[model samples]
Target: MLKRIKPGQARLGMFIEAIEGSWADHPFWRNQFRLDRAKDVERLKSSHATAVIIDTDKGVDVALPIAMTERSSPHPRENLSLKRALRTIEQSKPLITEMFENARIGGTIPVSHAAQAVEHIAACMQDSGKALIEVTRLKARDEYTFLHSIAVSGLVVHLARAVGLDEKMIRDLGMGGLLHDIGKMRVPLKVLNKSAPLNDVEMGQVRLHPSHGYQLLAKQGDVPRVVLDICLHHHERIDGSGYPNGLFDKQISIAVRITSICDVYDALTSARAYKKAWNPRDAARLMLEQEGQFDRRLLMQLFHSLRL
Candidate 1:
């Protein structure tokens, strides 16, 4: 049997089935756990959370008076429709971190595993992209690189859906976004995390990441051409003024156009060591002014998709 009780009524032996609050508000990092410590119970009581659900099957149940009479309500985060998507993002982080570490060692990324991760994100995006986007904003400073990958993946999946692409193509684009900056693993950590602006030499090295990422993906060989194109050309411009290859107009593919817009959108809105994050609306507005730097038609589509 399951019972709900106020945090004040929680006991040490109770099996905490769920904490009725936001992840930030909860005393524990995870939703469910055994309330076996006096500190844990006290922590829950002191938190802003109003209630917790307990499973008698797993541990002690609350007293009948409170469990049977007093009502306890679960918070929205506990019952959110996008709960599974939030969980998926948590699960994907370590896997992606390992993939990047492997790449740093000259090992091939596990393509099959990456495809599965993309599919998981796409499924969640199809259901409630707003929740996933909200989840992305909660990432910490050290997690910027990996979570940025996830954010770009979510944004690309959202944009691809808005533009009416088929499921396979969307998954491929999500994969492209996920691995777009894989080459950054090759850049020195000092350069990647410097608090001050980069010198010209460091800036030049930073600019080489696209080609570095392109070459790394190329060596993998089995990566899809669309994915490769996005990895290589997402930084290129429309009016003949972008880098690595400086390819102009029709020279760029639709995949590159879409990925580039989504990539810049995530970067501009994400916090880094050197700059604070831009508000989504402000970031979109700034991108709109870049003129020939981005595809205007696609940018408008992205703005519409974001409901801006």
Candidate 2:
């Protein structure tokens, strides 16, 4: 999915050098990097190339080119425009360090480097059709709306595959998951990233997000009702203890129930200011201990389905 790029993230009129599918220690990637640096890597950087990523193969070259606009590259031959690449990056990331577990084997990732990583993932997804986007989700927190979208998408896709949803439903679930937290974009970053617990007033503002998200998507009218319902009802619970609408067992769709479990699990497992991630076993134990807070059957399904 595409999103609007924020300020300072775009680097126009640059020589963006992109490589694909060459693993480290592999002769091809090592040789290519050596040859390129020996020749003109400094020149490429000086040209202000937007982002560069070296991967394992060469048939795919999905650069968010300086002049393309299409988001879905469709086939390998098409060029991915920079705007679309920025859109995908903004739509699918928190930042490099948060998204991937071992992003920097040994050093700090500054703001500029983090931004470059987001751009690279977007370009790769648009260019290569690879969901290496998953790598970014490895250690993410609730940093931005896009981070939430990516997390929810992964969880939904994982659950959909386990439950045997067909291709269309699975895709729909992905789109829904991607936008489930769109409303949060309107919330203040200070509030969303609050260093301390929220008081009653701030908590109320947070609670309004689902209905707000529903309204935003409702205005667009492109997403189906099921997807919209998932956005709104994902916060609802099986035992009637959730918000936006405290939908109970018979009140919610099975899909919505499953999504809630997945969403909760992903959020909990992800590192955030308010909480640290629990180990997979510990997280499952906590969920199971909650009992009526979640749908028993679906929680069981989700617990067993985790890639961990």
Candidate 3:
């Protein structure tokens, strides 16, 4: 029998359907499926996720227990348990909902206000670390962006604390991470949501977001340059393979360097439409193997930071 899990409870199980991100736009959803109840059941069975979040977007489907989907082959990020995923959804859903409401009202949740929330997200990571880690990591997929931003910011708090950074740096890192991708709001959703691979032209348009984000955040009152720099350079690479500026070592701030590593690590380990999520170990190995691409010493620090 399929398990019905409470919001806070998690478990493991097998998949039955594709969990749709609410941001996913398809004509059949409204025009075709609107009048068909039987179709929904059939579609659900075919897509067959063991547990699904009823009213959310971006990793909203909470799998029952451990979940195993049909393998396209072995993937690095495929270690999520249905239970853990659901537990994450349950634990994270309410917090994200609150953040959304607050953001809509133009209430800025400052970095200082995040301490309690950061601890809570960190605590949730001990078990069911799949969406647990990412929920704390960020959701990023519309109506979910603020929570995603907060999740990234929360990670900065935890990570900064892990490395014994001073309180000011920690706060700066969190705010920077939160606002890092704010530029994407101006980009076209077609490019953001396209299921197919983006061509070079499309990709080029997508890449302009860092500058856009920096400009957007700059207009807001008193945003620290540190945060603005993160918005600008989080895409930069150690070997200069990153976007926008393609800056090299010493050119990027320590904060950008730190946030860059964390951002990429979370993206690799989290589920996405175009790519299966990677496992932490695999993602780490890949990052490690990238060879002179990332700040090794900083990566090491970040790795050790995860132990806390």
Candidate 4:
């Protein structure tokens, strides 16, 4: 059994299964470990993690009655919301991993599975919008690619609803966001995960993902046109500065526009191997400063919708 306890409650004998925060907020390189060193416990307590998940079966357990109750006692409703959000993300992992892996190997794209994942994400957003978004923002480095798709999917749904799009279109946009970076599967891991700045060749290869993803989906023969459009054009900026075709504002559809904002916002707020995650406020502000990179009206709408 796993129990969440305050970081302060973490003792030397506990087995830390996970820490409840982004990778940038924790002091340790890995999430799971047996807390054997006194200094390590102190380090964890001083870190920005609000809670630590300990596997009670592996090491000494905290007093169950007190630890469990106190963990949820402060705000049971909020805790429940977080748990639902976590559950939704966990359910999405295998579905998404399989979907992307299949795409990488020339297998058919599972539209039904993708739609089901979108529905799960959409339902989670409706039930716990803030909690779901907050949970999506906390991505582990190794899980970044998978979690990023989930995060962008949720963000697009949220923004689409905020803009009052019809239900079908909203779901299509969700699907688009979910698979927007499918082309990245074609990029080599060495290029994708490079810690240092990329050379021109690497940068060019990275930029090809939109077209790569578009071709992958286009070959599927049954993907929605809207989804295919988003996969190809999410990178295209309003001012024709983006990749592939460098489409101008008029050529971009509203769905793609919404997706672009969400895509960039999630990317900005997510921790990458080459950069620390920017806080929401800073990320939004920086996006605003980048002239013509996104649709200003929709971007503002997104910021307002998210209350950032």
> Which candidate wins on TM-score?
4
Candidate 2 vs candidate 4: which has greater lDDT? 4
The better-scoring model by TM-score among 1 and 4 is: 4
What lDDT, from 0 to 1, does candidate 2 have? 0.52
- Which lDDT tens digits does candidate 1 get at residues 10-115? 6544688888877778888876677644457658877988679987666555542112124355344423433555566756766788888887787888877778
Residue-by-residue lDDT tens digits, candidate 3, 82-193: 2343344444445544533443344543433333444444444444344445433324344345545555665566667667788777777766776677666666778877
List TM-score per model, in order.
Answer: 0.76, 0.58, 0.63, 0.79
Candidate 4 Cα misplacement greater than 4 A, ranges: 1-72
Query: In model 4, how large is the Cα lDDT of residue 217?
Result: 89
Q: Model 2, 159-228: lDDT tens per residue?
A: 6767878766766666566556655654666788886999998888888878866766666545567778
Candidate 4 per-residue lDDT, tens place, 181-289, comes to 9889889889988989999999999999999898888987889999999999998899999878889979988988999999999888876779877888999999999
lDDT of 1 at 155: 90
Q: In lDDT terms, which candidate is top?
A: 4
Give lDDT: candidate 2, residue 198: 97
True-structure RMSD, every candidate: 10.3, 14.4, 9.6, 8.8
- Model 2 TM-score relative to the real fold: 0.58
Q: How many residue pairs clash in each candidate?
A: 0, 15, 24, 0
Better of 1 and 3 by lDDT: 1
Model 1 TM: 0.76
1 versus 2: better TM-score goes to: 1
Q: In terms of TM-score, which candidate is stronger, 3 or 4? A: 4
